[model samples]
Target: MWRRVTSLSHLLSSPKSSPQLTPTSYGPKIWETLSTEVSKKSGGGIFSKERSPFITFVLGGPGSGKGTQCSRIVETYGFTHLSAGDLLRKEITMNSENGAMILDTIAKGKIVPSEVTIKLIRKAIESAENDKFLIDGFPRTEENRIAYERIIGAEPNIVLFFDCPEEVMVKRVLSRNEGRVDDNIDTVKERLKAFRSLNLPVINHYSNKGVLYKIDGTGTEDEIFERVRAVFDAWK
Candidate 1:
């Protein structure tokens, strides 16, 4: 995991202070507690316009290799890749009260509550020093999209959809061997179904907004990333 050293906690500790991008090892539970305490003390939300980051939301099915390509993009383009799934998994490891629920949700291939997932992403954004971000596996539902916009008060500058076939995605997931809770065949099917029923609309929303760049996610990682590179290059 790429991490930046920041002093955001010190800033948030003060009731009237605005958040300054700072890295902290505090878990999501601590961050949420701090945020709620701060909100009550300050009588306002934690977000501010000064914290607006140039975000790219990466959308894809169960096994579209978004994670793999995101690493390459981070290396090549200097963007922070914040994987929502990874964040949730970390919460489980931290023995959070929501851990069992998140584990069950992932095993069933259902989306975690939007608020829970967004809080993790929000903390990541606040702590990172980089302005460019690739937010992976987020906004999996319409509610997720709405909650993120309402809470974060910003939209993604670009949305990258890895358009891959269902069969291809299944194969990739089966072969992934990543020890993820949702990597089994049954879970993959459920995830694909969720992607179609829930995630597709989010993609379409971005498509209509004209910030969506659909990449043919069928070839080698390098080949697919070439197409991805072209899209980001044009954006630059």
Candidate 2:
């Protein structure tokens, strides 16, 4: 199972403090949360410019290995990967009533209310220590995109879509051993259905606007990552 790069509790304890980016005990299969001793150029670590900072949104259906690819990018390039789902899941683990409700909602494969999700996105972006980012498993709706535009004040410079077949996704999810409540077949099916019925349009909108790039996701993990690497390496 892939655990979070680190516990946010550790980060929150010393807020505004840069702890340290230790060598990751977990392998390269996960995003390694990192902190630096020195404050970077910008207080938030993500630079503020007249236009948007360098950012990319990773979009894909379940089992398309979006998380795996994000991990790879964080390792090879110096981009921070912010997963909206992981942050919400951590809130659940905190065991507050809020956490419990979020955990239950996540397991059900429904979207968390937009305000709740947007609040989280704002905080995560503000805490970043890196300018480049690969945000995964997010903007699952047109509403999600609009909220980001309204709150983050910038849209993504690039959007990467991992295009995989439904059959392949089903088999991959069934075999995925993370033990995530949402990884179950029933939830997987519902999520997929919801993604196609609801989320594909957001993807298409980006594609039409010339900001979308598609990578073939039918191959092995290494093969899929190679495609993502090409897209990101060419990032300006």
Candidate 3:
């Protein structure tokens, strides 16, 4: 799936998973899209700088147990978890035009607009009350990464990829019972296809940068979380 995001296909594919969802590799290419442009408002005081904390980009497809692992990370560590899906879903709930499109696209496993997705991520970053953040379910495209570097101005400390098979992910989503509109098998299939499409390139971006960490995604929630914790432990 991570492969699809970065080596991403234009069209949707089958279901899959990658740590909380690390199945693929990421490298420097994702950052290649960065432009030299910077906005003064978001540039945030280049003269008198505070310490820049490392960011952890937690990436995965839907039902990849990212949320579960994020909870564990928050409990043990103090990093904030910013879920892109949750943010988009919130927009859908509010009945925004973009939100409506996102819901439709996600249900069909299609990629959302990079600009819209990045805008949501930027919002989360600006509103962050803490220095450390675990950005989840974002940058599913090279474009996503570029937008972040362009708009957000910070690179990730590490990129965590959850490695799980498509079959496993499909089963998990079907049984998830979260009452999400995108959780049913039909929509899940589309979501999975979209996930496969966007994830490869994203993963490749992180892997090439040597920041990608792959972890087995099969098992109970605790088991999966333990793998995630292990990454943080080594990093910390």
TM-scores for every candidate against the unseen true structure = 0.79, 0.76, 0.76
lDDT of 1 by residue, 190-226 (tens): 9999898999779778767756667778879998888
**Which regions of candidate 2 deviate over 4 angstroms?**
1-52
Residue-pair clashes per candidate, as listed? 2, 0, 45
TM-score order of candidates, top first: 1, 2, 3
* TM-score for candidate 3: 0.76
Kindly list the per-residue Cα lDDT of model 2 for residues 132-229, writing each as its tens digit.
67788779999988887666655666677777888989999889788777988899999899888878878877767656677777778897777666
Worst 10-residue lDDT window, candidate 3: 1-10
Give the number of the best model, judged by TM-score.
Answer: 1
Q: Rate the local accuracy (lDDT) of all candidates.
A: 0.76, 0.69, 0.68
Residue 67 in model 2: shift from native, Å? Answer: 0.6
Worst lDDT 10-window in candidate 1: 3-12
Query: How far in Å is the alpha carbon of 53 misplaced in model 2?
Result: 3.1
